[model samples]
Target: MSYIPPHKRQLKDPVSPSPFPDSLATKVMKNTDFKSSSVKVNIAYSRDAIFKWFLIGSKGISDEVPPSIKLVPVSSDSSDSRYGEKSFVLMNTNVEKENVIAEESEEEERTRWMLIAEKVEKDLVVAYEQAKKGMQDHHLSDNAKLRLVARFGKILFRRIHAGPVTEYWQAKSSNRTFCTDVPTSFIQNIKSKAIPSHEFCIDLEKEVYVVQISHYTRPHSTIICKCTVKEDGSLSMYKAELNPLRHLVVDVSCIDKNLDMRFMLAGKRKMFTLTEKERSNIQRMLDSVTVDSTVKGGLTWPHGKPPSENGYTIFEVCHVRATTYKNKTLRLRVRETNGYSERFGTWEVERGVTLILQDINTKLQEQNIERGCVLEMLRDALGTIWDFLHCDASLT
Candidate 1:
């Protein structure tokens, strides 16, 4: 998973009255004013499903992502018996491999971004504890501290999803642990370096520099983001993805079991929709698995939006040309719709998705094509995790 924090982007200051006359990607419907001091921003969450809309699925089934927190059209006052049934439909798309791969990579980035969950949680905890003592015994002042509590609370709640989480794994000689806070700045330093949370703006004319600061925390675990403040008072949002080879620790035991095709199928009994040809491909793929042999193949996966010139726009996958069975080769992009490329509707493209297919397309043109042993293992892990999330009995 990558670091994908959604924020409103603008090209000028106080964008309430800015004329949004049918841009390429964004469709401005209701008129709203953008205030410098405060602006109302609503978006359908990419993850942490709440209310009616959850994020899209890997297979792009009934994955119609809608605006987050906004009320659905079906109200209790409706006369129809089928109340609360969603009226949404899948976003239209075209047929193309490049576009799908683009969106897939972005989604893949989100999956990898969660690897920083533990670290981010800890950092937030430290921020909270520090904020706690800042109180001067006043009742109202203490309530102000409560605001800081939301930050810490949201971090942990979002990470485990307010659900049961197996947080740590430890053995006699080796152990792994996660925390909500790791001491960074003392109370004194924090006060001085505190950058007040500002509504970030995106400036088109200025240089927008994306910095990936790895050394600020754990060499591979921590990531720091910096972007230019635009004239419209929006700062560019970041979709920081994790590089498995460089960032993730390899689990030998899990790796062994995942690579074993039989082991992967041991508990999975739940049904999945697959064409006969797709089924045949899966079976043939499993039969052909070999140690040290890499298969460079991309899954003919589906995304929510239809494919277009710039891929399917939002929730799309691309550049899925090739990947190592052992190494990751996916690229996901999260951008605004009104920017250079577009996916659909008249809304700012808050975030984007990209999927990775571990097939080395380049190798298809060559004589010798090696398969990636690790990707085989990864596909199983991803499936198992996803199945668990979707409440599939097989994963249990």
Candidate 2:
């Protein structure tokens, strides 16, 4: 009778119950064509609402939705029901593929660095061999020899700074040792509380002497002073070299006791007695050491382990060939850890001191050589050249 909509007419007959049961009603609603509805609403929103309702009914309704279930908008076309599901599957597949690509790129980068490091190591070894041969050649002038040695030093310096090739030599010579230790003590002061500084000198001659002094000293500190024996037989200083020690590889022994201490600097042995204070200090450092026999240095520790109030010591035995120092024979050395000391103090210090010593030693040796004697000149020249080139610069 009245101009009522078809939806309103259906609702007006509230007194009549539906013939379908609850489960059947849900199935019929799911199968219903939303395009046939008289009410106009967002098609996508409506589909999402229906899906959410079905999920709630199956899983039991709650105030908050479950985390695992996600609602997404669907297309207006009722026939394409599986479109949203296909899109979600494609998105997941794309993410997995992207992750795989990223992983592959990272692996490739690491492999590239490894290859670069290997090349650097090979180049260093070749350069060293060439320099060694060139220095030995009598035909090559002093300038030519210096240039060759300098080129080798430059290569070594550059490789050391290069991030990829640092510490390459340690891995190559992990098993090599160039050190020998003999149990011996100083002749005098076998059991003395007070240790004198002059006792640490090994006299090469009255004019030329090799002395063991503290590694840390002022740049202008006088190491070797030229003195004249006066008429009264008193030594009078005339000339002095502010910085005399260069390219010196020191070997330390008698660590167990301070009664008689020994050190080998530039292949010359010096002996002395450590004072009570020095002995106690060294003893404290050596107490809490953790030893590893497998490593080249036979010592391992956490990187940048700071010194404690009690003191800290890391002992190592190193081979001369494995070190930057160009000593002829295989020998073992022990020394105190310095600022450059990393996990292995002996290895790190040996490598680090090379550049510093070379920069100074090359200049000093060139100035000190006399012009006349050919054999003596060659000997001195070869010795300095060997020190420059005989370094473990492998990058493996």
Candidate 3:
């Protein structure tokens, strides 16, 4: 007698049969087109499930994308409890083909940016080490050290195409990075050059050509001041001691007009209108003063308020993958919301969603999601919605 599987036995007892009907199962078996390897079926996953699975899948797979699974909202009747009006789903199917292609292109772009950033970081690190070695070995002056740093910063700024970064020393020491245009080294270099000397020639008759100091009060105010340089080298502008030359930062440049020499002072305050008939003279004068001070030194250079830094490393795998996944999910939802974009405008919806996304990002950041805690926090933030309709064993 041929052995028969227990499931195929004809004995009818108090047995828990599979949910799928025999006929459907038979059809599924017979259908040649329903190849399991290529056929993709849509299935809904709870937010918690998605977070868990994504984390696991990402870690497990090497250069392999997660299997295509469509995530829909958990049905209202599926569970006893319900939560928010907005349920997040991970639906990759609803996105248009063109949009998918665009996402792929974006992925490529991210990869390129990451590669470039990595190279920049390595180059900067080498440069920084070399500068430190030079300072240690050659006993380079503080000014020379700063100049080396400035040169390094210039390379970074030119290549990154982003805002200035804070000092590499600070960034490296703190084990953190920022995204800003102003390199700390560049600022330090300027400060090193602009050390102020309080010694002012006490000649009250010295004529110091001044620029209009009231541009804020009057736009296009080209009013020039013919003033006597005070004993303290400050110009008396309505009793306000405007230190135009001796105590100013090295950010002077000719702006707006050929005659207008715009320069920011040590404290980031501006006072403008020293000029000559030839614009070249004004440029040369600015350059000369800055060079003289930088070379000869002056009083302690005041620090400018630091530029804000909020940039992150682009090469972190965890960050990039998380960002990519979030973007994909966001795109899918955004497209769903704009289904009425053709018939009715999506202005209102788009505005509302922008706020929502901002809030979500804030929350995500608050979680302090490192690689270890990322999946856990994500799962918690996105509560579970149990799917009960289709059991794997019953389907089989």
Best by lDDT: 2
lDDT of 3: 0.19
The whole-model lDDT of each prediction reads 0.21, 0.23, 0.19
What's the ranking of the predictions by lDDT, best on top? 2, 1, 3
Q: If scored against the real structure, what TM-score would every candidate get?
A: 0.18, 0.21, 0.16
Predicted candidate 3 versus true structure: per-residue lDDT over 105-138, tens digit per residue: 4334323322222212322233334434444464
> Quick one: best TM-score, which candidate?
2
**Lowest summed-lDDT stretch of 10 residues in model 2?**
10-19
lDDT of 2 by residue, 1-396 (tens): 222211111110000011112233355444434343222211111111111111111112222323332212112221111111111000011234334434554334333323322222223233333443443453423323221121110100001121121132112211111111111121112112111211222212222111111212222232222333344423343432222121111111111111111111121111123345644543333333334435443333345352232232322222122222222221112222212223222232121111112322233235333323423322343333222222211110
Model 3 residue 274 lDDT score = 30
Q: Which stretches of candidate 2 lie over 4 Å from their true place?
A: 1-244, 247-274, 295-297, 301-340, 343-371, 374-376, 379-396
Query: Residue 108 in model 3: shift from native, Å?
Result: 4.0
Q: Itemize residue pairs with steric clashes in candidate 2.
A: 177-319, 178-319, 178-320, 178-330, 178-331, 178-332, 179-331, 179-332, 180-332
Looking at model 2, residue 61 earns an lDDT score of: 23
Ranking by TM-score: 2, 1, 3
